[model samples]
Target chain A: MSVTSASPSHDRPHWLALDRLGVLITLILLSSFLLPFALFRANRILLGDGLPLLASMQPVAASVLLLALAFGVGAALLRLPALIKLAAGFGVLTILFIAMGLSAETLMPADNNYARVSPAAGFWVLVFGLALLVTDALTRLRLGPWTRIGILLGVCGAFWALLWSGLWNELSILKEYANRAPAFWNEARTHLLLAFGSVAIAAIVGIPLGILCYRVRPVRAALLNILNIVQTIPSIALFGLLIAPLAWVAANVPGAKASGISGIGVAPAVVALFAYSLLPIVSNTVVGLLGVSAPAVDAARGMGMTWLQRLVQVELPLAFPVILTGIRIVLVQNIGLTTIAALIGGGGFGVFVFQGIGQTAMDLVLLGAVPTVVLAFAAAVVLDAFVELTSRGGRRA
Target chain B: MKPGLLLRVFALALLIVLLVAPQAFRDFFALFVRPTQPPIYTQGNLLDITLSHLMIVAIAIGLSTMVAVSLAILVTRPFGAEFLPLSRAIANVGQTFPPVAVLALAVPMLGFGTAPTLVALFLYGLLPIFENTLTGLTTLPEDVMEASRGVGMTGWQRLTQVELPLALPIILAGIRLSTVIALATATIGSTVAARTLGEVIIAGLTTGNTAFVLQGGLIVGVLAVLIYDSLSALEKWLARRTGRLTRADA
Candidate 1:
């Protein structure tokens, strides 16, 4: 963990040599094999009857061994610290992966086809990979022309991988013991996608309102108040509330269904998530717009610009940072709430939460909630980078 | 009075348009509030929306103002300059955290009640208030602060007598923010099964009943706009009053 720190310790403890590029190579090699197995189960496997991860766990186990051996040999032959670090990292990560694969957990107590290997193996692999990646990225960090942007991108990439790939993968993971893990993973993935979609929708609607409110007091007050009320509504209830309008539309509308063929997935999920994101966008937009300053406005107006022109040309550019901050909040919030969307068949991570609650399966709960938490954190970090980038852009302008 | 009344009318018109527009969703509207069912938007529902809206607004604004004011006090002192930006950023982050996350995290400890919703509302309302409080407090004439200190006023004395009076206008703006945020967030109480205005809106949305959704959403929107406009008016009034008082006292 210290290896990933921005300011590394001078006397780098050999145990946590973060800059050990050699370790990254090894870690990746071990992960390449293990992850394929897990990913295969997620994307390719058909969970019909009793099925182990493979007819024999021979491939992953063998690949892990081979990966570890290759890294160690490559490290010594080259006499390069980077190579050595990669080799060692790979060996350790592979051992971890193989050990986890061997101890795969049962996904469902009652079902047969719904079982698979434990997903924790992939999660740890991702973590190991990320640790190496972050460390390497940090070592290469330097002040230059695109330094801030580079740093921001690196941070965002790490965050995206952690959220979108790691914790998120756990929710819809592949299993060796059975397909239950994959089943659970699918439900979570659906939720994540929908939740992300919901946030996306919110951004579409809220950001504009936010910007509008900044320049127009009457409008801003109205929007802020509406969003404020929306913000106070609890998650479960919001989803519940969203049902009414959508149901009404679905049932009454001539040809339109609520979500699509499913008539449930996107419509209700998007509405609930959208309602939740309103405040962040509206609040942020108003603040960001206001931050554009009176003089900037005066100057623009003095330049004989129209109100619309001043807003688009001056206010929006200045207000971009604050707006990004809001968007970041909206994104993070949507990630968490998307979990609750499953209750309505909107599908996503909430399937695990609700299903686990019903079956009293803590493993299923972990399968669902863990990914959401990670995704939320990852989302937050990425949003922050975007916010900073926008802010810097604003400053430069 | 005339313009306020006119705005109120316009707001009501907007509400009616939204609510009645969902006659388009007639079939979906029945799930929550059946045609045979007693009207959900009776005096009780409106009153309910109003009451919940007020309670949340009160709590959020009350708590946020306290926090912002106290923090403003601490950070506006002689040695507190460097901490100002940092404190503001932390406040911003607090506001940035989704109210849903706050509610989710609060659920375990608070166990699905107004308590969690209240806490969420308060935290979510923190940023604007905190920033405005700092802006209002700090932007006062430097001479005023120095004059109070020069004339042998203690820190507390100067704060209560001079600084706070000057900052009150800006602080009111923060309070306005808290009120607006709290009003909307109170709707989230439905997640915990806390029967509030959100109950109506959520009920409407879940079943695809646009009327119920429209009805509930309309009520919320109207209530929010009215209350916020009032707070804003109050802020303007306070700013003017303090402006006069500051000049007269000078």
Candidate 2:
């Protein structure tokens, strides 16, 4: 804490005050949207029955009250140790989750199992506020990457426990889940395959393209222009364009359909995802290879290494980090883009989102959207770690 | 003044004429391209739809540039330096959230229209501009910054007159990327009834009309390339202008 706080007087330490934190908490408390949050039928969120805050949810009110008081005190102190701030942020998140669980239990009349409660726009704003608070505190903590990963694992474990223990059985999103629990895994599997398959294909195609761009100057401009043009074609249109050609191939060719190359479904989804993944991967590959120093290559040649040996033993290792960075972008991006697969019956978490929108079910949308985000984030984190590990190995060598 | 710039101008003018009078394309499209299927997307005024699309993209990019550039400036400042990681995490979240998911979630609240699309586009646009701003400010030449300080310029003056002008090219590059991306993504807005070019594309998809899909795709693709080229020129013009200033100073 002193490390950060001990700024030179001339540098001007930015003050952390009670009123600033109070404003966030106050807004959460005072907002009308939070005051009369929605109570929905088990089936839908669009048809909301408003429930007044203090009257309908005593536990939630108390929790928020206690959180505000604690935050107010912390803010009044002006500065605190990093660990303490992190703990406070964690406590705020804990209170939010517990309040959500408690509201699920107490708010709905026990007699009617079909009744559900959905947090209103104000509740979402409060969630956003708490997230900002937590992010600020976590940055203050300055935890190492491994420790951050550990914290994420802990959070995930706790969340899983909450779900498995059925404490959130009454939550509207979980109700949506209860109906499609079996199919959810299938969709998840499809989403993963589509994302990863595209990455694999893109790396196979794009790395060579990048290398070609590096080696052949004349090929670079035309190839890049084509890829750029392809990149700008919106995914929806790209998907639509693929339909006709793919349908023709599937209809005319003897074995195309059997090979999963149909107009609609996983085939076209994977193709579109592959196209989207190419630009980043190819560009990165070019940048990484071009970035390798001439001296390093010369040294390898002087050592009597063959061109292949020089590339494998020197250039590739040096280029690995940048290449990995490109792969990371493509991987994360493909995870998000694969959600569109469900639009064409390719099947992913987007099925839930589109269906939910059709039914005006917010929880179902969350059910799909939340996992897709988590998957993308997790893929990014893992890829980043892998890149770091590989680069560290290169440095050691 | 460059031939490339002149060509871009001519191309843009032609595009405007085509969008405003797509009947201009209809006869030409029929003559040059073999329409495998009849285009059913000719009913709506393509100009109005294109303008609406551009308007939505403009609003989203404008809002994002303001917020993202401000946040970038803030986090790069001495007082707000610690918030850098938090800002990055927020931007990453914005990127990671699928626009479709945002649209689906927002439709219930905002109804089926541009509101949800705007929200999605704004969120999607944030990361590129934010990252670019951060890179531009942080990567300013250290000696140049010291020279500004040694010359006794205040922080605000140094930032506005020196740092920002030097960083303008990179920042513009980010904005260019964001704009192009937003233009492409805005087509999806039609799915939620935001009255976009994506309507034509979606209509084609549902009816399997290849001609309609081609028409929509061609317009959007051409628009992206033209905007991209124009922005690149602007970036180059800024760089050349700054280059002259630096040379004069030397």
lDDT against the true structure, per candidate, is 0.59, 0.76
* TM-score (all chains, Cα) for each model: 0.56, 0.89
Lowest summed lDDT window (length 10), candidate 1 chain A:
A39-48
lDDT of 2 by residue, A89-148 (tens): 566666666666666677677777567776666556656666666666666666555666
TM-score of chain A of each: 0.60, 0.87
DockQ of each: 0.11, 0.52
**Superposing all C-alpha atoms, what RMSD in Å does each candidate have to the true structure?**
11.9, 4.4
Tens digit of per-residue lDDT, candidate 2, span B105-220: 77767877889999888878888889988988888888899999999999999989998888787778888888988898888788778888998888887776776777788789
- Tens digits of lDDT, candidate 1, B75-135: 7886666345546545644554545556555543355567767777777777777887788
Q: lDDT winner among the candidates?
A: 2
